[model samples]
Target: MTTTPARERTRHEIVRQAMGLFQDRGYSAVSLQDIASAAGCSKATVLYHFNGKAAVLAAVLEPAAADLAALVAAADQLSRAAAQEFAIGEFTDLAVRYRGVMDVVQELIPFIQEMPELALLVADGIRLKGFLAGSDDPLEQDLAGFALNGLTAECRHADGRTDEELHRLCEAALNRLFRPS
Candidate 1:
């Protein structure tokens, strides 16, 4: 069924409001009523748009997940060395662009395995980490990959940094982590 323009607008508003709430208060802390209130609607309206809060969280994270999947897909098409470079640049851009969503996802990590909606995102993350590390030894690559991921996520929390600044800082850190010894 074709959605009415008004209905689409309301749905978008709910997702937008819910994203901010999830980013600020985290998934567990933000109730459906909280999302409705933030979106200037009733709890019933929230339920009308979403099955529940998990659906809202899924909606909030969907765009970022799609982008990350695309990044991984693009990197997969390249040669190993090229994929490493491409993934590093693209992932840094994505991390900065979706920093709030990244923050929310980090909060959800303890429960990520249980969230079916986030399974693709987790898989894409592992693939991207492999591209970032680019080492033959599992131990070396895993350590390097986790370091790059951790530093990039932590850099998103840096206050007073523009998106450009965050991107540059994250890129530098990733480069350092992946640099040849």
Candidate 2:
């Protein structure tokens, strides 16, 4: 369907407001009225633009999800070591760029398995974890992957840090995590 400019603008606004609400309040705590209030639209207008809250959440997460999928696909084509470096760099870039979304995603973990719209993100996350770990042993790789994931997620909560600063900090921590012992 061809979206009129006004409709597109309203959709964008809804997604933008939904992202902040989801980040600040968590998905379960946010209501259609809350999103509508933040977006300066009526709840029915929100429903007109999106099917419901889950749809709004999907729209809010779409950009970051697309970037992550692309990163995973690109990294999948490289050698193990090259993929590791590529994934780490790309993942840190994503983590910093989508810090708020990262927090939302972290909060959504408990529900991700049940959200069909988030299935690609969940799969890409698994692939990204493997690339980030870059270890030969299964146990070591799992441990390293979880640590890297936790580190990136926690860094998003570093108040008062600029994006550049967060990028550097996350990149350095990731590199150190993957560095040979």
Candidate 3:
């Protein structure tokens, strides 16, 4: 079995701490010094791992992308009904896990609007795979990811909805997308 390298593990901790700070204070409000103190490391250590705040945020994104990919892959493996349930549950879990970071991300929308290229990269990370069979067009696939984001946001706002309700709603949406007449 592979183990995380010491340096990489430290970097991960630094990034995690940095994420919390960024979420609470936002990107502009945060600094390398702040991250260093939050992480209980030296400024040089933070710099050694990340060139700047942007790099630190981007590093946090990499694992999030991987986690989303894993969820999509798992959904791909399930039967139609089961896949919808999996997608909903997974998406709910992700929304909860990343709400703070996502708030930071939502804060970047205006910047993304100004910088189209950056927006594209962010959108790409949100891209969904071919959740339905024979629907492999890249553009359609990309929209699915965007659609998933919409659902997740809705779920975030929904209060007092039980897990079962959320699962049913999400599964119904995905099922409609995949079911053939």
Q: Over the full model, what C-alpha lDDT does candidate 3 score relative to the true structure?
A: 0.66
lDDT per residue for candidate 3 within 7-81, as digits (tens), equals 988898898898888778887799999999988889999999887777787776666656777877777677765
Clashing pairs in 1: none
Assess each prediction's global lDDT (C-alpha) against the native: 0.83, 0.85, 0.66
Error of 3 at 1 (Å): 16
Measured by TM-score, how close is model 3 to the native structure? 0.58
Worst 10-residue lDDT window, candidate 3: 125-134
Ten residues in sequence with the least summed lDDT for candidate 1: 147-156
RMSD, one per candidate, in order? 2.7, 2.7, 5.7
True-vs-predicted CA distance for residue 39, candidate 1, Å: 1.5
Sorted on lDDT, best first, the list reads: 2, 1, 3
Best first by TM-score, ranked = 2, 1, 3
TM-score of each prediction: 0.89, 0.90, 0.58
Error of 2 at 180 (Å): 2.6
